[model samples]
Target: MENTLQLDLNRSSHSCREDFSEYVAHLQLHMALQARNLVPNLTQAADSREQLLQETQAEFEKLVSRQMR
Candidate 1:
């Protein structure tokens, strides 16, 4: 009887470990997808900022040229 109980406990422990491992794998996948989604949005925002800076610089140069004339 004691040996049977020990076997049951071992099985339960193994099952729990498997469950935890699966949960961790799923969490990692979810995080990777989220990061993937964020990359394009971040890239777009950076592109927009760079475009705005270029426009501002061009306007400044135009203003300086007018003042000199």
Candidate 2:
């Protein structure tokens, strides 16, 4: 009876490990897909940010020039 219990515990542990590994694999796949979708949007946002910064910098320089004049 004791040996049977030990065998059962080992089997249960192995199954749990397998389930955890599968879950992790699925989670990673989901994250990779999500990241793939997000990359283009992130790139566009970065470009927009750069454009805004350039515009703001140009305006600031104009204001500074006016003040100096």
Candidate 3:
């Protein structure tokens, strides 16, 4: 009886370990997917900011040139 109980406990522990491992793998995959989705959004935002800055600088230069004239 004691040996059977020990075997059962071992099986339960192994199952728990497997479940935890699967949960961790799923979480990692979700994080990776989220990061993949975020990267493009971040890149697009950066590009937009850069373009706006360039336009603003060009406008400022034009204003300065007109003032000098």
lDDT of 3 by residue, 26-60 (tens): 66656555644543322233577766755665565
Global CA lDDT computed for model 1: 0.63
Off by over 4 Å in 3: 41-69
Off by over 4 Å in 2: 41-69
Residue lDDT tens for model 1, 1-69 = 999999999999999998997777666656555644543332233577766755665565465445434
Q: Each model's C-alpha lDDT?
A: 0.63, 0.63, 0.63
How close is every model to the real structure, measured as TM-score?
Answer: 0.57, 0.57, 0.57
Query: How many steric clashes between backbone atoms does each model show?
Result: 0, 0, 0
* Per-residue alpha-carbon lDDT of candidate 2 for residues 1-69, written as tens digits (9 for 90 to 100): 999999999999999998997777666656555644543332233577766755665565465445433
Query: TM-score for model 2?
Result: 0.57
Q: With candidate 3 superimposed using the best TM-score fit, by how many Å does residue 68's alpha carbon deviate from the native?
A: 65
Model 2: per-residue Cα lDDT at residue 64: 46
